[model samples]
Target: MYFTPALLAAVATVIGLATATPVPEPQGIAAGSIELCTGQYLQGRCTTITTPTGTCVEFPRGFHNDVSSVSGLEGWNCNLYHDDHCTSASYYVQGEQDTLPTDNFNSVICTPPP
Candidate 1:
C-alpha cells in the first residue's frame, strides 16, 4: 500500500471529529477487567462493583456526589478526566484511592492488562 501526507491529514481529521464527544460522554472504555468501586457507582448510593466491563463509562455533565475517589482491584488502573470525552488532562488512580483532584470527574478510561 502507498500513503500520502494529504491522505494522512484527511484520515486524522476524520478520526478527530469522530472521537469528539460532549462533556456528558466518555471517550474510551475498558473491556472485561477486574475493577472495584465503592460509595456509588453511577449516581446511586454507596455500592460496590467488581469485574466491571464495558465499552465506555461517562459521568454526569457536572458535579455529582459519586464521581469522587476510585480504587482499582487486582492490577487495574484507570484514568480520570474532567471532560466528558476524556480529552482534557487526566488523573491516574489505582489501588486504595479515596479522593480525586476535583472531587468529581467527567470520564473514566480503563483497559485490562495485555
Candidate 2:
C-alpha cells in the first residue's frame, strides 16, 4: 500500500477526535426494585442512580461500574450529550410495588463512587 503523508495525517486526526470525545455524565436518579428489573447478576444491587448533568453518574458501590452498561438499563432512558454526558434520564420499574427511597443518597451527593 502506498503511504501518503496527507493520508497518515488524516488518520491521526480521526484518532485524536475519537480519543478526545468526552463521555456523558448522569443527570437524574432512577428508581426501581430488584423484583421490578431483572437480568444480569449485579455485584452490589443498584440501590440508587445519580444523574449529574454534563458528567458521568458514578454508581453507588455495586451494580454495573461501567457507564455504558449502567446506561443500558432496559427501562432507564438516557439522554447523553457530548461523549457520555447525561442531560436527562429516567428509570423504568419492571415489577410493581411501593417506591422505596434510596439509602445511598449521601453517596450520590458527598462522594459518588467511581
Candidate 3:
C-alpha cells in the first residue's frame, strides 16, 4: 500500500468533519429546533440557548399579530401549518423569510432541499 501526503490530508479532513458535533454552532431555527428547542418549549426552558447545545424558540405576542412573517436563515425552509401534524403546509421559501396568513400557523414541518 502507498500513502500519499495529499490523500492523508484529505482523509484527516473528512474524519474531522464527520466527527464534529453540530450542536455547538448556530444552524438557525429549524436545526436549532431539532437539536434542543422542541423539548424546551414542551417542558418550559429545559435548556437555555446560551448552552453549547441549547436553543431558543420565540412566538409573537397577542391578537394584533399574525405569523405573517417567517424566515429561513441559512437556507432553512419549512412548511408552516394551521393545524397539527403538518396539514395545509405553506409554500417553500429559502435564503429569505416566508409569510403566512395572519397569525394562523400552529405547527411546522421541515423539508430538506430538493
Q: If both were scored by TM-score, which would come out higher, candidate 1 or candidate 2? A: 1
Over the stretch 1-114, how does candidate 2's per-residue lDDT look in tens digits? 897999999999899888956779885643422221112332223343544322354443333222221223334333322222233333332222233222211111111222
lDDT of 3: 0.42
List TM-scores for all candidates, in order. 0.48, 0.22, 0.37
Identify the leading candidate in terms of TM-score: 1
Query: Candidate 1, residues 1-114: lDDT per residue as tens digits?
Result: 998999999999999999958676574544533232324432323333333343345653333324555656556667767766777787877565665556556566665655
Predicted structure 3, TM vs. truth? 0.37
After best superposition, candidate 2 residue 28: deviation in angstroms? 1.6
Residue-level lDDT for 90 in candidate 1:
78
Residue 7 in candidate 3, Cα distance off native in Å: 34
Which 10-residue window of candidate 3 scores lowest in summed lDDT? 44-53
Q: Which prediction has the highest lDDT against the true structure? A: 1
Q: What's model 2's lDDT at 94?
A: 29
Going through the candidates in the order shown, the clash numbers are: 0, 16, 2
- Weakest lDDT window of 10 consecutive positions for candidate 2: 102-111
Regions of candidate 3 where Cα sits further than 4 Å from its true position:
1-65, 98-101, 112-114
Better of 2 and 3 by TM-score: 3
